[model samples]
Target chain A: MSELLSITATGLTKRFGDVTAVNDLSLNIHCGEIYGFLGLNGAGKTTTIRMLLGMIRPNTGSVSLFGIKVQPSQSSIWQRVGYMVETPHAYPDLTVRENLEITRRLRQMSATDAVEKIIGELGLMPYANRRARTLSLGNAQRLGLAKALIHHPDLLLLDEPANALDPAGIVEIRNLLRGLAENSGVTIFISSHILSEVARLATRIGIVHEGRLLKELNANELAEQEEQRLAVDVNDTVAALSALGKAGIAARLDGKNSLIITDKPTMQHPDKVATLLVEAGCPPTRLVVEQRDLESYFLGLVGMKEEKKQ
Target chain B: MIASVKAPDNIISKLVPALWVELKKVQRSKTLWMTALAFSLLIIISGLFMYILKDPEQARRLGILGAKAQIFGGSANWPSFFNLVLLMVSLGGLIIFGFIFVWIFGREFGDKTVYDILSLPTPRVTVVIAKIITAAYWSLALILLVFVLMLGLGAMLQLPEWSAATVWNGLGLLLGTGSLTVLICIPFGLVASFTRGYLPAVGCIFLVIILGQVISQLGNGQYFPWTIPMLYSGAAEALIGKVTAPLGLISYILVGLVGAISLVFTCGWWRYADQT
Candidate 1:
């Protein structure tokens, strides 16, 4: 209900006969924030995006964009919203430029050069005259982004924007999105299955599993939750464990060849552990600090790994 | 602040851009050209049949005439040729015109581009209206193409019974049948929208055509929307006049009512139904 919120959905629920696609979902995204919606496939990410764009209606709740309630008949609010849902699809027979032109005209923009500008911005010039059916998946994705961005709207709801892009293309889009948020103040709600991609770009991340948001964390909080451990490769693992234990720093054997220590003090000061090991005549051969990646963190939060552990 | 900008009050103002977009999409697709060619081929083939009927002895000598040529009623004239064209439109128009409606609406779902247009700055109703209007214009274009081709081919074949009044009457019936056929095909757009693809709509068209034939043969052609157009085109008179009644005012009203209801249903579906 807050006017300042750029996107708001309250008690949003959608059920298809016996299946509930999205359940009691609520989200509030503010201006200029890159909100990452992270979920596995069939986790209702696309369904939520569809609801937000008014492509599908929620059975039990309301969605508002820019403080105005969303209805299928409403158009003025859409002028300020740009969205790319699921895989971007254009008329296969139409050229990339023609596809963009159709979107520009449908959006009712008077500027004739908007299509040209977006084509250039998205690096679609090389394939501008090519039919969409002929383009590779990467180029097709670029075309989809071009259509969504042609009007330069204030809000963007992208579903897997990096689905088929190369590493460089993904980085370019990341930088472009960063610039859009920083310079133009565009509020972005991007959904992705790639945890690292979202971790690197989002200011806030919401992890959804089984149609429910399991957690919402900011950048600093996510970084803090990353599990850190001190790994040491000693000439004698038993001696190293004994040395660390005698020093009151608990360490366990890992992989039958290395010692893993999650003890706060030992992780904070690996040099002290090295000295203790050396004093015990079990000098370390290799020592390094390792942190859990975003992928593992996401999987751990979703209990995907717990099933594996069990 | 950007959200506060008011949309245009006039429907036409909002409709123009959407219409332009729809036309552009139609122009880019091969469906229009393909349909036009199909109708042209129908006209030319009908002309060839007339040519064979023109002189049975010559046609038989040339091996072009078959025993079925008797269906031409042993005549090759403007009146018969025009009636043949009317029948063609009444029958072929259901598929051709229905295909146009199906592709125009169903391609969005097939190409998976429905999501792109569903949340655009233009109202969904405007988009639907624009598509309907485009389909109307496109169907007219096809009808016009058939009309012109039939005239030129008829002239080239130099069939008998050429008169201004006859030609005018023929043209009137052909056009009236074509218009009614186009009006009835609007419901296919609703089928396409509801079913969200081309196959189901095409199936619906075939079902209606078959059902129309069966119902018309049962002596209730005037009561069915699909049969009414063919009845108005004089198909019943040519085939089974004794059983079919004259098409009444209620029949035309029924056609109009079906069209209006389908259009309203399609618009309502776009406006209120969940589009997953």
Candidate 2:
């Protein structure tokens, strides 16, 4: 494993009696890149992260982080890894300054860089003296983010890190995560329901559903999965259907006048369809182009698993 | 020219940071200040009545030591008023400590913060030990602080000289009383780590305390109260020159060993535990 591959695990499996939470999962995350681990509830995202952290052992598999084996006897890799699971609570009783102080002490972060510098970078000075319990969720998250960044660890594992945050808070955290990955060369593996936000921040994305990794694709790959669904407004529905059939293009009528065409939105495909429609009696006009949504893309990827179960 | 330095290892040190973070919860939540205020008031109120208005003059002097001894304990010098107040200090924060401890260890699941804890590089056992250690540290510190406060009160009242044996006995009770908290807490900490809520962990605490109170009552109170504060240590009885271990040393060892071993086993499942 290279330094770029901050964490690597293969054939990982965890069983609870008869139930298998994670099954032979294998993954390698690179340094200075944000990898989004997308999954629904109980989709083994948490289970996999736990194995990576060595909090739980896989029944049959091995894990190494930063080139070091993840065994109970070895924890040097942990010193260089930072993680925030679920909704992190800063010491509610401790003031912001005190919380940071404790985090600094825990991470043993005494060197040229200090807690004061990180504290300032996190913009926590205003509420530095107030108890953590009194801070807003956004502020508490900032404090959590501050704690994660205190030691400047090379690897960060976050699970639904932005859950329950307002839009602004989400954007702030998104910006912060991007900045960390871009400027400091930190490797982050994060999981969240917000796939588009994940797309905005993650360099690469892995979609896991039903304890299995469906696919791992980059932002560009997701964007490249473009499909065209057009709204065709026609006067006579029968005539429109007849014309669309003649063109060998598939389309369904929306209500009575509008027909939706499902096809690739390439210029050539749309142009060919337009030529075929104009040749017919009902010439199509007011065609609208729609991009594939995350939900649609995700459903196209993993929704079939649920359907199979049904 | 500088020497190349090697990075430090040993994950145990990470516990300090994570535990420090856990301890800070008390201060951030206002529960610490709230507990201290409530404890201070309880001391000033009930203690003033118990010590000052209750003919403490007789309790303080060697003149009435015989009568006071009958009432407090058999020839134990009526627990110098300060020590009496200090013993009662534990009672004041018992509820608060129970709540805080449950929150620290179990409430992560209750309030969903366990995810934050397990996701970190810190071990599950370290998290468990840190909460217990934090609670134990605070309990011991507050008890000692109250003892000092009572010492000041004793001076103001001009109480008679307290014996070295009484002081040592008081110290033993003070340490021993809180030590019982460790035995009491670890089992609950295990349950807290194993179970899913603050209520069940808290329910276990009450069960232990209630059982201890009932057992102490059934055993003629004073004789066994000090004896079983964590175990049947003759340390308190030894303070007054009484010899012979109250319970077999092996019994004491067994109680600690069984509790420690059970706690560790519960931690074994933790290797499979997720962020929560």
Candidate 3:
């Protein structure tokens, strides 16, 4: 199991003076798996990535890449791991090609044309000669991804990879990362505050809140866990409530002249709800069985966690 | 297939690529040209001083310009010109060389690109060494430029005492003093790393320059690393009138030791310190 995992972090905890940045976080991302590390700002996502890259030492526990211990002295491990933490930065004075060339040389990549190849692949050929400082925010993010993917490492850790990107660029990056994972079997541990973005790309999602992993689930499990509610509007709201009460059904008015039903049977059977409301002399005007989105689900989890703390 | 990078058995293999990257960055920056232009101005001013000394009567007839030239009071000859060049390099080297070191090390953090190189196949220590080597190369190149420009001005002015012995001695002193000053500026790299920016390291350079003057005045310059280059340049003897003793081997050893320790600390900070 350990051999099959590309990243294994056990009981990782990091504290900065009086503040505990990350607390008892553990994760195991398998090879070729796209793991979405979902967290809001200051949720220790960057801190955890730093620990995984051996950039910062954890107060307790350890991290390993390819089953080898992660330490600054373990220079060999970095060759297989590529990462971009936070907003990616490039040498502002150097051109896009020159910046990539420096990365190639420092990476000891013998292929001389690797810079051009990455540029073409990242659709940066038009801006190849332009200085990094002159490139737009989206182009800069592309350049960052290009540098990370230039060497094609097996494990790529990216923090907020879609930051400062337009909708088209975000989709381009999403497809690029998905292709890398699906075709090349690259294990990607991507951190982002955008849950919808991760929902569309990640196979497994881990929600981190207040320096702890609040939840971890696969796409299907996440969908199954989404809270479902049946919403119905009728001509007579008071009579609809009376009908539901007489029929021994749990329902309430949502303060907007609509009845909200959260019971599993009622939500699974909206037709029965409509028939019940219709027979009570209150015809249904509108009906909807709404499933909670990943964003609200994420916020709800965080809100619940905060509520527990309070 | 992912290509594997071999671990370096020696420093040279690791240093080559890192050095290449550092040199490319330095080559593309405007700071190099700005520093070069400043050196050219220094040489031109020295030439103007020599022009004034060549004819004291004509200089005095020019009013305030003549009086200001008198403050430079040395004879308009190759020996004096050589001493002037050495004096400029010795003091100027601290500001210029220290500036180069601070910028090379601090710009990464300043520009927020430090994270890019932190996790590469090349060791962080190799990168630190490469930056130091680049700073030294830049400082020496500036000194060489000053030496050649001074020679041109002296030849054009047709000053006397233009012997091979004087030129060679001047060349040796400029190179030696510049080299020592470059060596002394190594700690600023550590300072840049510690402060994580160029502004603080620039402040450190000014502090070192002022302290160098104060400690050299206190007559304990031979023991201070920062003051050794100034004293060895023979400038302190002329300017301060107190530093008369010739620099011994101990002074050279102290400079070398301080430089070596600073290099180690810079590398250690890169290797072990949490670059947050």
* Candidate 2: segments with Cα more than 4 A from true spot: A13-24, A40-42, A59-62, A162-176, A182-184, A233-242, A248-287, A304-310, B1-6, B9-104, B107-131, B149-162, B176-181, B213-227, B230-251, B262-275
lDDT of 2 by residue, A113-199 (tens): 456777788888899899877998888877877877777778888888887678988888889889888998889999887677788
Backbone clash pairs for candidate 2 read A56-B271, A56-B272, A92-B28, A92-B29, A93-B25, A93-B27, A93-B28, A93-B29, A94-B28, A106-B17
Residue by residue across A1-310, what tens digits does model 1's lDDT show? 4557899999998888988888999999999899999999989999999899988889999999989999865777888998998889999999999998888878877778888888999999999999999999999999999988888889999999999999999999999999999999999999999988998999999999888888999999989877888888887898888878888988877665787788887798888988888899999988998876678788888887522110
Which candidate number would show the highest TM-score if scored against the true structure? 3
What candidate 1 gets wrong by more than 4 Å, as runs, is A1-3, A231-260, A268-289, A306-310, B1-6, B62-64, B236-243
> Could you tell me how far off, in angstroms, the CA of residue B129 lies in candidate 3 after the best superposition?
0.6
Looking at model 3 chain A, which ten-residue stretch has the lowest summed lDDT?
A301-310
DockQ of each: 0.56, 0.25, 0.62
lDDT per residue for candidate 1 within B140-159, as digits (tens), equals 88878887898898899899
Candidate ranking under lDDT, highest first, comes to 3, 1, 2
Question: Chain B in candidate 1 has what TM-score?
Answer: 0.93
| Chain B only, TM-score of each candidate | 0.93, 0.69, 0.94
Give the candidate order by descending DockQ.
3, 1, 2
Looking at candidate 2 chain B, the ten consecutive residues that score lowest on lDDT are B1-10
Query: Which 10-residue window in model 1 chain A sums to the lowest lDDT?
Result: A301-310
- Comparing 1 and 3 on TM-score, the stronger one: 3
CAPRI-style grade of the A/B interface in model 1: medium
Better of 1 and 2 by DockQ: 1
lDDT of 3 by residue, A97-153 (tens): 999999988988787888898899999999999999999999999999999989888
Candidate 3 residue A136 C-alpha distance from true site, Å: 0.9
Per-prediction TM-score to the true structure, in the order listed: 0.91, 0.75, 0.93
